[model samples]
Target: MSTDNTSLHLEKVVPEAEDFLPILGTDFVELYVGNAKQAAYYYQHAWGFQPVAYAGLETGKKDSVSYVLQQGKIRVVLTSPLEKDGEINAHINKHGDGVKFVALWVDDARKSYEETTKRGAKSYVEPYELEDENGKAVISGIHTYGETIHLFVERGEYEGPFLPGYRVYDTKAKSPDTGLKFIDHMVGNVGWNEMNKWVEFYGKVMGFAQLVSFDDKDISTDYTALMSKVMSNGNGRIKFPINEPAEGKKKSQIEEYIDFYNGAGVQHIALATDNIIETVTQLRDRGVEFLYVPETYYDDLLDRVGEIDEDLEPLKELGVLVDRDDEGYLLQIFTKPVLDRPTMFFEIIQRKGAQSFGKGNFKALFEAIEREQDLRGTLN
Candidate 1:
């Protein structure tokens, strides 16, 4: 249960992050998928995401279709191509239903784009305004790791369901909320020796500070290893952890992701929950598969993380792992890859007070992942 407490969690004041990009929160994450209609159904029924907005032929969109879903503070846009060949189709053909944009909520999209582009960020889209009867919304974008883009969204003047060009999506079917809150963090997997390059990109191009870092020694199993560094923007609303494959006996998860994804891309997203025990239970009941954690890992749980509020029986039953930090302990669990490819997944987390990631559970967690990789014959 013991970990390199000092190095695993950076103990610094929040103000250490620069204020150049004052992010309010995550606006929305847009994913280019093979089928937006079916994907939207899966999200609604399986993940408890309610339909928010829709844009397609009905809304005068000829090339592509998009469906926006939201649960609590988390918003995800599932988009698909209508024509045979286009940018969205090319993205889906290459990446196989992966994230395209990690949009950030900001006050001024124009200023955010200018600041980052001036600081070396390549522009994906210049500042533009989308207006409708509801009001007007301004947005801009910049390229990040791989083909992923970071979009700055300014919605102070808009009152529509989502952005302009989208109509309020109404559905007769109901999907209950799972108590999932905001996005805790999103993880990206890079090519060999590319971790530091993206780490420096966030620091120099976007004014983010390194929150914590882990080498192979900190996050390694018997067969695989990877390096990761967490980056955070000012006000601590946005966090991204960049990971790269380290030397190991077998292929690490980062390497596997890059192999299947064809390049650097988002590997997983961590979603915060107020009550993980209940949320995980609901997700399981709705047919969500999670990684298998052996019961032996919980034998010394109390001695390792000390006393906690939750009953250990339920946590053990749900295969949830616990870890402690200077502030407090947290509970977390990872779901199996939701897509056909073993690339993107989700992490359910509930933090009482701990700001750190689950460092103490890295070994057990990675071992569980290795077991899955073995089943998929990707462990070699």
Candidate 2:
């Protein structure tokens, strides 16, 4: 994975500011599931994530179990409650298997909590410490859209497999590395007309700024339409694109997600990769399904995106889409829904010095999504 471009690309887009809080990067994305063990295996075998740590009945007294998976700079915690009628089980019942927390790494957890709460953010967890043999780390959290939370993690002096509670979970399973690097951006699908409210909430509560905006007019097809606005922190380490359904000839994809998800929540996560061609090839061979476009898209792709380093045949054969801006170009492709509910999915992206989102590919991408939703009977 290309880890060298993060600092350079973020510097070009964001100017230094005397903001109240400074976030380092994403610590992890936590998912609440009905079965953490099987879910962990699914990620490792399907997405090439390595098993890192685990917390369950074997570790100690427990009401829930958690499994940590890592690859490159990405870490995901899959948690499941052992008891019925608990909060974790309640969340799983309502939303199915989906993201519950988008944890952010910070330097000072207490200060970050105070700063955000003072600015009217709802508190999810007070600043607390968890100590181990290595050291101590502080953490706090605040509520976000749906039941999801944004946890502020300060690893202070602590150094262990994960937190103080988790132990190393070793396994004999082996999967080839797929070259997925880190989280590029997270997209949230809110209800109708709720996008602007959350965008303003991030601006006022977390001191983020607007990076880009897309309305229904620019990103729409004949069957469905949606509006999105991208928000980023000052250092540009984290980006969240909020989307809402716009009136169309039929139900938009955002509406379908909301109907199935039961509320506003994370729609998809875009993971950055250095070599998407190789990464996707491995993922496809390993049973990961991706959305496909008509061959006609590649016929005029070069004319639209101009010359790219990769040839047209490989990209078209693999069903990858290309887009460009003044800064540079990018190649991106989306996977089909990973869960049974058609709720959460993923995107494999390779950015070739491009600082902006792939705006040019939205029409084709949304049309593919509409096709899927139609088959699922979500679009009427």
Candidate 3:
């Protein structure tokens, strides 16, 4: 089995001071959905996120509504407008309620915009400063695949809860912290022949490098297949894995996402937490349903991956999966389809020390998914 040699060697790490600016962390993840209210509830109740702020007709914003949810340092915004025909609707129709904005927090939005656009990025939104009574903030955006965008947020000068007109809501009920620290990685699904196109787009346009690559041969089950390549910035703070569907016996997950989402767009956002057990448990008790691996798989967990740092009992009870590499071990779990179209989902990950994605667990994960497909009667 070929392992990620780059992940194993600490000394070979790519320096971050090159073409990229220092990223504080993920500022917010904005999803464009059909209905922001329902989406907000799904995230707040099912994902253990607490309501933070809101914007809608009540706020005099007629075209759209947005709800902000917060858990730990993570803030997610669900946006849906009243209009039925436009870019937002087209995006939701094509992507089946996926991520539209990956807002990155930086020290200076104008500088970040200038640096990236000068390097060849397509400008989505020019740098503009928004302010209220508290302070001011500068935000800019650059285009990514399909209708997706990377928003540069300079919040050093702002002090309001989220943005202008968003007053902090004091809710008596707070969701339990799931140990999630920040956004780990986000994955995108592109067209049939567009994987390398985006890899190069990130490489040449955004100063990202290929962290890992998997051909259809590497990530295929008996019924489905796809190609994937992971791209990361110099600091490895932001990772995006782009995938494209390959010919298969049945409709691949990538194809399903494209079919319902209307085109190539984000497939999932993988959030990293410090503790998998606590995070997943809180999420489940809050109302999240997860994709289940068979109970029999746990019967041979020790034999397959060897003894892990975590006890097998709790892991089996929680249905979390573990894998190890030369660098270190990692624990991860996936949430079931969070959207009606099976297009959007999330992953809660705890990287004990490992940097590599769980290649060894692909077969097991896909098998579990195929079982779901069988039940849904969507398997081709």
Q: List the candidate 3 regions with Cα displacement exceeding 4 Å.
A: 1-13, 16-18
Query: What range of 10 consecutive residues in model 3 has the weakest lDDT sum?
Result: 1-10
Residue 44 of candidate 1: its Cα lDDT? 93
As for candidate 1, its clashing pairs are none
lDDT of 1 at 302: 99
User: Considering lDDT, where higher is better, how would the candidates rank from best to worst?
Assistant: 1, 2, 3
- Model 3 gets an lDDT of 0.80
Instruction: Kindly report which residue stretches of model 2 are placed more than 4 angstroms away from their true locations once superposed.
Output: 1-12, 16-18
Candidate 1 lDDT (Cα, whole model)? 0.91
Which lDDT tens digits does candidate 1 get at residues 1-380?
A: 01111212223356767667777778899999999999999999888999999999999999999999998889999999999988988988898999999998888899999999999999999999999999898999999999999999988877789989999997999789899888999999999999899999999988899999999999998899999999998777789999999999998888888988999999999999999999999999999999999999889999999999999999999999999999999999999999989999999999999999999999998999999998989989
> CA lDDT of each candidate?
0.91, 0.88, 0.80
List clashing residue pairs in candidate 3.
94-261, 94-262, 95-261, 96-261, 178-279, 180-273
Model 1 lDDT, residue 20, Cα:
77
Model 2, span 201-230: residue lDDT tens: 888889888888999898899888899999
Residue 176 miss distance in model 2 (angstroms):
2.0
Clashing pairs in 2: none
